[model samples]
Target chain A: AQSVTQPDIHITVSEGASLELRCNYSYGATPYLFWYVQSPGQGLQLLLKYFSGDTLVQGIKGFEAEFKRSQSSFNLRKPSVHWSDAAEYFCAVGAYTDKLIFGTGTRLQVFP
Target chain B: EPEVTQTPSHQVTQMGQEVILRCVPISNHLYFYWYRQILGQKVEFLVSFYNNEISEKSEIFDDQFSVERPDGSNFTLKIRSTKLEDSAMYFCASSGGTGLSDTQYFGPGTRLTVL
Candidate 1:
């Protein structure tokens, strides 16, 4: 079974500071990992995904994630956090099936 | 840019009543999906639809839940008898392909509250 774990329940960062959200996944084979952000009263937006090829992938809003197979981690990172970046982040893994297994989200709070 | 759209941002239904949540996926997408998130919980996959049939479903999608694509543009999820546990934000998503690399775009969820 595919599963995801986002160990950080909440994180607070100063505005313009670096941000890194940790994510770890479990799957038998190669996993399709994804990072999604959910703003207040908004839908889940895809930040980036790792399917194959390069270990690092860039996504919208200046976000990027590096896939580390050895550690089974695909952590999201942003060099500078903006106030609007305060939101809930989720990590997910997809297996042979179409379904996605998601982890408990991490709430990001950006302080000015 | 095309995106998935869902109706009834919030729905309040009495326990034992039926409720249907609607969605309009991206015009060109071929695969549709339904997911739910209870308060303080992770999002969960409920069902996936392709070629007008269910390709896969999670254990949470049981007899009480049903889905339909009545027309070309609309996909719907129906709860036959809403229960208190059914209270959650339901999200609809669509993907251009079923492959692992394909991205699934989500719509603003419909918050269902059963009392």
Candidate 2:
């Protein structure tokens, strides 16, 4: 079965520090990857997605993800983290049928 | 921007009782989906609906669960006999198109607590 794996359970970063959340997937074919963020007491928000393109896709809230087929990974990266960036991040792989298999998620804590 | 909206932000019910969660998808969306997240767990897909019919459903969505597009805009999920394990946050999502590339917009979920 297809699955998504987010290796980081929790990550702490100082404000203005660089951030990287690792994600790997197991799928049969070229997968449609996505990154979503959820703040406390809020709904899941789409940060970015990778279907077929230049391997790098930019998204809202100054977020971006790169789809690396060789590594079977789609890690999310941000040059600088803000206090507002503290949230839970989920990586997902979309099936051809449009069903999304999501990872357990990585909780980010940004400190001042 | 148009967004999906779900009613009854939180619900508390006794075990074995029935509960219906309602959602109003974006006006132009053609595909709708239901997902659930147990406390501290990943979001799991339950079912997908289109054209007044179910396209795909996960094993987690058994006879106990049913979805309907009862009206042009309202989409609902009904749990026939809720169990204690049914406590979770249920989310409704919609996509403007049917393809995997289409973006799905999710609604603020309804927290169901079965006592």
Candidate 3:
């Protein structure tokens, strides 16, 4: 079955520091990978997605993700983290159907 | 920018009672979906609807659950008999199409607490 894995349960980074959140996925066919972020009591917000073509994808809020087919990874990165960037991040792999298989999520804490 | 909207940010209900979660998808979107995330767990797909009918559903969406698009604007998910295990954050999403360029836009979600 298609699934997603976010190895880091929690990550802490100081303001203005670089950030990287790891994600791995398992799928049978060509995968449609996506990164979403959720704030406290808020809905999931799309960060970026990789369907095909270029491996590096840019998204809203200064977020970017790189899809590595060999490693089966789509890691999210931000050069400078802000205090407001603290939130839970999820990785998801879209199935052939409409449903999306999501990761367990990684809680990010931004320190000042 | 247009967005999917859901009603009642939070709901508290007793077990075995019926609860209906409502959503108004983006006006021009053609596909609608429901997903839930249990506390500390991955978000799971419950069901998907298109053309006024269910396109697909997961095993978690058993006989206890049903979905309907009553009018041009409202899409709803109804649980006939709510269970304590049903407590979670339910999200409503919609997409213009299933094509490569189409992306699903999610609503803020409704937090259901069944006791």
Candidate 4:
């Protein structure tokens, strides 16, 4: 059984500050990881994904994630936060059957 | 840019009535899926479809639920009888390939409300 865990329920950061959202997964083999963002009443937008190859993967909207096998973690980070970036972020692991198992999600709040 | 699209942005149905949710996946994509999210909960997979048959489904997708690619572009989900617990946002997703590595693009989602 594969699962994802997003420790932070909500995080508040000031504009121009750095942001890091933690994600951990439990899987038997190499997992496919993804980050998605959803605005209020909007569909999910894919931020980035990691299949294999490089440990660091860059996504849209200046977002990036690092995959660490040892800790079973794939954390999302942004160097500078903007108020428009405030939304709910979800971390997911792709299953062999092509279904995605998603985390509870972390709500980001950006303040000026 | 191509993206998945769904119909009936918000549906209000009475309990015990039937409801149909529609989706139009990316034109060239082959695999389609249905997922639901309860308010403030994680997105949960319901079923996956390919070649006009269900490839995989979760326990949540049971006897009461069925999916069909009725036409060339329309993919539909039918619920035999609506329940209060079924009130949630239903999302449609599609990928160009069948493999898990392929990126699955999501639609805006249909908010189903059962009264």
Query: What is the C-alpha lDDT profile of model 1 across A3-104, one tens digit per residue?
Result: 889999999999999999999999887788899999987889999988999999999999999999999999999999999999999998885346788999
Task: Provide per-model DockQ scores.
Answer: 0.69, 0.70, 0.68, 0.70
Task: Give lDDT tens digits, candidate 1, residues B1-115.
Answer: 8989999999999999999999999998899999999988899999999999999998999999999999999999999999999999999999888565788889999999999
- Candidates' TM-scores? 0.96, 0.97, 0.97, 0.97
Question: lDDT value for candidate 4?
Answer: 0.95
* Clashing residue pairs found in predicted model 4: none
State the displacement of the C-alpha of residue A85, model 1, in Å, after optimal TM-score superposition.
0.7
lDDT by residue for model 2 (A34-63), tens? 999999978999999998978999998889
lDDT of each: 0.93, 0.94, 0.92, 0.95
- Tell me the deviation in Å of residue A34 in model 4: 0.3
Candidate 2 positional error at B73, Å: 0.2
Better of 1 and 4 by TM-score: 4
Query: Model 3 over residues B1-115: C-alpha lDDT tens digits?
Result: 9999998889999999999999999999999999998987888999999999999999999999999999999999999999999999999999888577567789999999999
lDDT of 4 by residue, A1-112 (tens): 7899999999999999999999999987778999999999999999999999999999999999999999999999999999999999999998444789999999999999
Evaluated at residue A56, the lDDT of candidate 1 is 98
Q: How much lDDT does candidate 1 score? A: 0.93
Number of colliding residue pairs in each model = 0, 0, 0, 0
RMSD to the native, candidate 1?
1.3
Query: Residues B1-115, candidate 2, lDDT per residue (tens digit)?
Result: 8999998999999999999999999998999999999999999999999888999999999999999998899999999999999999999999888665788889999999999
Candidate 2 wrongly placed segments (more than 4 Å): B98-100
Enumerate residue pairs that collide in model 2. Answer: none
